[model samples]
Target: MDARRNDVNPQKYYVKKLCKIIYFMGLGDCWYERTEQSRMQKILYAIWATLINSFIILNTINELLAFLRTDLSVKEKNDSIQFRFAHPCLCGKYIFLVLQKHRIRALFERLLEASRSVYTVFEVEKRSVWQAKLCCLVLAASSYCTLLFTVVDAIVGYFTQGIKIRTEVVLYPTPAHSGLLINLLRLLIEVHWWCIVTNMILVDCLSSVAMVYVAHKLMIVKLYFQNLRQKVISNIGKKSDLEIQKEYEMDFITGVKLHKDALWCAKNIQYALGNVYSIQVFESITLLGMCMVKMAKIDINLTFILANGLYLVCVVIITGVYFSSAGNITYEAYEVHNAMFHSGWELAHLSPASRAVVLVAIQRSQVPVFLTAFGVVVLSHNNFISVVRASYSFFAVTY
Candidate 1:
């Protein structure tokens, strides 16, 4: 597909579930081509995104005030705190994303192009593509399962107990209380919670997908290194020795830049999404601890318990997705260094400049490209374990 054309080939990426949710939620206008979306459509989408964000913000504030002002049950308060604190991070995520959408889009386009290059070069493919697909499925499954339990539980609770507001974030003014009016009020409240839930899911899924995308690119870069010999030699079918050395130099330089770009992409991703992940880590611990305390405090219904259990599992899966993706970035960075030697760079007689380029590539790749939050809290499997420990500590104290 030609970027210069007005066609919607790029929309292929947006056809997936992840982009569709972001689209309807109005966070996906950027995904559309210029010709595909009208000015008014973009304006309305922007307005919709803002409204959804505003609703979630107000919902959070309302619930915080409710928790402070009213004497609620232990279970309600726990659930309220858990939902409230966890999703306000979405506002921060939204701000960062929108402000830097164009830059990130360029980076994403590069990743997409690199994916194509990998496919073009290696038709049979290797484990990287499948690995990324598996992660994508895990990410999507996490969101789907959350929505499943959430909607089901919401329906069950509504039928069993009419006009209940979990977080007390009532958006509509249904002050004239009556049977029909009461039902309408309850329904509106449910819709409000759904908006908030959707907001939260959008944030989580987008960030997780971004990590997976970057990791896939890094894996593709690893493929470049893994096949660096074939990659360079393929261009050297009938070339002379000097020409071949120059080709080697050129390919080595490309690999180095590719390595650097992957690292740069990882860091920029950390800039855009790492803070939220950091906040999420603490939020999950707090929420998890509170969930445990709620369990010990009272005998909850099975539906409620099941919802909480799914929430716990998702928290782990989401965090693991982030941490594992980051871990893979570092692992591939180092692997590129090791792969340099195995690339058969020694087969050809080289000049000083070529040798220096190879040396620089090895050195740069040696300093593993790790992602972190605010210079602390490295996103890796090790810290994933730490998150569980911290949550357990919180539960111990709160209990």
Candidate 2:
């Protein structure tokens, strides 16, 4: 199948937009073809990327220093003051930025490759187009909602309190007094913070969307096997022994090929996202606990409750979707064996070669497919539940 034939594909449309945004942020240079550009243009892009990335690095360092200074000062004046909640939040953002800076090229390339694999799957099944479209819509909605909420909260806080609210993990020091120049600087800072927050959210959405699409494809593959099984079983009384054997052999070979393709795609997903998954899992666990602690300490007010509640809910939903989709992929792969057995493979008359192929397919399907974080912790609903429970336990102890 020609992956590029789907010029109007919603999945491709959104993924391309995401790549453009990432490139515009100056986080990566691989989004476009460098070979098409002149030498001078390539050098200019390199220079621009370096300057933009350096600015982000310097800003992160300044924020980290400010956080440390404030944390120390608060501890000294009030021994009971613990910045426990803030530390992990800050560290997670820092780690993410550093990793993204260094790994953007590899990450983007792998994501593009995985997306092509998914596109191939869609080409095989016409009905899967609806799933692809729905995935794109969900991603766009999530990204827009997050951006709108962050911008609205920041604007409201700034106008009402004459203080710039950091909507993200950056710990910028507030200005001591209000002036025209100070206000403008604060506005710029807020805009920059908003961009960073938007990028972070988009990255998470992209990764989650990709995983969900893969799960959808896996489900399609499972259905194909199931259909094949039924077809084989139904042919028992209608077909001769040689005809049945030949049909079984052909179908078994096709199933084997499909399974191999699915597994390859699964491996590509793991390679593309393993490191990012590990970091995100750690961040979600720590941040949820911290947010819960902060919410408990705040007075009961509608705004406070809504703000904190939304934050926690968004975190859970995003992480939950990712883990659940990964689990689904594994589940669909493991069902292949059952699909074969139930297809009346035992009753079908097959040649020795056909029997050997069926046996191999069953053996291959026995080992389940899983998406792991850094080749360690498997991403699944069970692990997600464990993380949530652990976060609650930590919150209780700290509170």
Best-fitting candidate, scored by TM-score: 1
User: What clash pairs does model 1 have?
Assistant: none
TM-score of 1: 0.81
Query: Model 2: how far is 7 from its true place, Å?
Result: 9.6
Q: Which ten residues in a row have the lowest lDDT in candidate 1?
A: 1-10
lDDT of 1 by residue, 1-399 (tens): 001222222323532455566668756533433436688987887898778767667755655555553545555556666656665654565555566666556555555454353232232123344555566567557756765776676567768876353334332333234588777656655666666556555666666656665665566566666676775566565777777787677666666677766777777777666676776677667877877777788666877777767877877787787788778777767777777766657755688877877887777778867777556878887888998888889999877
Question: What C-alpha lDDT does candidate 2 achieve relative to the native structure?
Answer: 0.60
- What total of clashing residue pairs does each candidate reach? 0, 0
For each candidate in turn, the TM-score is 0.81, 0.76
